[model samples]
Target: MSMFLVRSFDDPKGYIELNRPDGTLPRTSSESYVPWGVSTHGKIVYAKTGEHTGWRGGTGQHRLRPYDTTVSQNRRRQCQSELGVMILNNPSFTAKAVSKVSNAMRLYLQSQDAATAMACIYKQIGHYFYTGGRFGFGRISESKKDDIGVDGVWRGIMQALLLGRLDQKMSIHDAIGRKVLPVLKGGQLVKYTNLATVVRQDWFDDPTRRGRVNAPVRAPVTTKGGISKLDTPAGGTVAQGRNRGVDMFSRDLHRTRDKDADAYYDDADARNLLFGAGISGTTGTLLQAGIAFGKLTAAEDLKQYTLAIIGYLVGGGMHSYHETMAVASKVGVPYNPGAFETSMPESFRRSGLYTAWRANFYDIVVLGATHWRNNSGYLPSHLNKELTSPA
Candidate 1:
């Protein structure tokens, strides 16, 4: 939600006014840079991120289940938020591909039992890399929100670390910002992104009626870049629409849109990411379900099963930690290193999982789904109160 002064709306010289705002603007500035550290933040981790425009998601999504009430994608903010959302999400335009050679290794090491314990220990990192039709990583609580396949803690961990590689792949904006760039004066994560590539030309088409940079009252920018848009993938509005996570059987699918909220997601590559995520998340749930049913063939050996279960927990925990450092990946936002601290482990500390994934974390991860059920929290108290409260 940070902003730069465009000098004059009537005739922008392309140079932003550099004087700091006098406590007037929303503190969304990424210009200032500092070495981010966990100690700087207390118990609750916080990652300051800004929207970037650069993505290839402009298609109709139908495969994954949606919520009862749909969300409006109509973007109406003041500043230009993204050069393009894809710019921040998909960075370098890398295609997601299932590694052929690695599959050979996977097959060689594949487990024939109803469940594969080896997976608890071995994950092919190179298998991801924005390949396999997979794309950008999702936000903190995005996975559970995307599909209704019951992505509990263990399953979420499996999905994030195993099959669902796109959550951390296919982003150049993140790579350059986290790895290539260093934190500068005011904790700014990114320096230059060459955003002109995706800047909507029409916004500047009419030289006379240009979009104001920081108007006195509200956002005047005519593009998607600006203040935070309403009901992000993590917002309360959209989150509540899905009844937290209770409306699992709801046949509706969360549709994808362009930065301008245009219908998209019909291309082969785009579909890859969508279906890839769906399948990945679904696969993890199925595995968890199988485990609940005692489907592991190795359990007959008692020793192996105990060892496998132990490995699953330990390895999953480590994977969750690894995600915190997955810069240019899903866990941490690009350019903003503090985002890592904000990252909640895949199996724990997810977006509002205290309700969405909490019970499952215990039932599945700890107790092996003794009380198996998917509950994303239908009647979220906070959401209900907000809705009924005096506006």
Candidate 2:
């Protein structure tokens, strides 16, 4: 979210004005460099605070927050606030993935001779990444491991480490800022790691169920002289989308104007992350369905499932279900949208199993069915009662 003013030492042109509330105006002075420890950059030009156009001074701004200087209380506050959020957001698949594996263990212990443990384990694992965190039996109070941790923690950590390879694949913009800028500015501008890229790494690889970054790329640039020269030979960063992990799913898919046009999956990694955190295999699926519905599902399916799930979850009656079905039949695609709108019920839709199927290939087919229903003027009132009524 931090905006930076970028300029090359080699440029011969005049000053560039930043668009602010007042108007676009040139920046003047800049301060001596100091490192922002959050990135690899050894230093930053501290832009001075207060909005002023043109070259008033060379000092750059340093972000600061005024606070009471009580040492003991502040220490505790920092640990509880800043450190707590950091741990939660640090993208540790180990802690989370273990939670799901542990849940599978607990279910195995409880079921005894009744169920297949491996299937339960796989389903739980899939559910966790899709949902991003755990729910139901996966809830913190009900978690199986208590505080001991899962047996598979080491393996989970290894997988997270392996996926970190994607983090090393720099975006064209990032490489320009980090690797290229150092040499360009006579080494004065300094190379700093982009926070957006770091956050994107966490956001993209996160198995924590429902998370996604949907913002469009604000600026685009072709690589500079030597960089472009080398990139052409190296098979450069020519892909679409902001994050490499996110862009992986976009291959061969039709591009959309929407920010997350190509992020669809049969099951998302976010589910696994959550399941690892102790959410139920089932609950994770339901939450992933909501997120996937918003970001990844087809448009026609969006209209149908939004109405259907919202109606069911909100305690609307058979009549509401009927109305939802009516709209869905008219609007949803039949075959390509996933499962049949006729097959979805208030209880079943919230149950997690149904939503899991929807996240896969079923929803696409169902979207096609919805188009057919819309064209045929089908009334789904009777069908809703027949399918959704307690069986």
lDDT of 1 by residue, 1-391 (tens): 2122322222223113333333122233553211111111111111122221111111232111211111101111110122113222221221111122123223322323313322322231222232233321222233332232322322443343334323221121123122222321112221122221222223223222221122133322121211233334321111001111111111113222122211111221111111111111212221222222222323222222222211221111111111111111221122121111222222223234222322222211222111111112333223233222212
lDDT of 2 by residue, 1-391 (tens): 1222322222232112223342112334553211111111211122222321122222233222211122212222221122112222222312232223223223323343323323333233323322233331111122233131343422332243234211211111122233323333222132122222211222133333222323243222321111111223321232121212211121111112122211322111111100011111211222232222123245433443333232221111111122122223332323222124443334334544444433322212122122221122222323222222212
Where is model 2 poorest over a 10-residue stretch in terms of lDDT? Answer: 270-279
Give candidate 1's error at residue 24 in angstroms.
15
After superposition, which runs of candidate 2 have C-alpha atoms over 4 Å from their true positions? Answer: 1-42, 52-105, 108-115, 118-254, 257-391
**Candidate 1, run of 10 with poorest lDDT:** 71-80
Q: List clash counts for every candidate, in order.
A: 43, 70
TM-scores vs. true structure, each candidate: 0.18, 0.20
TM-score of 2: 0.20
Highest lDDT: which candidate?
Answer: 2
Q: What overall lDDT, based on C-alpha atoms, would model 2 receive against the true structure?
A: 0.24
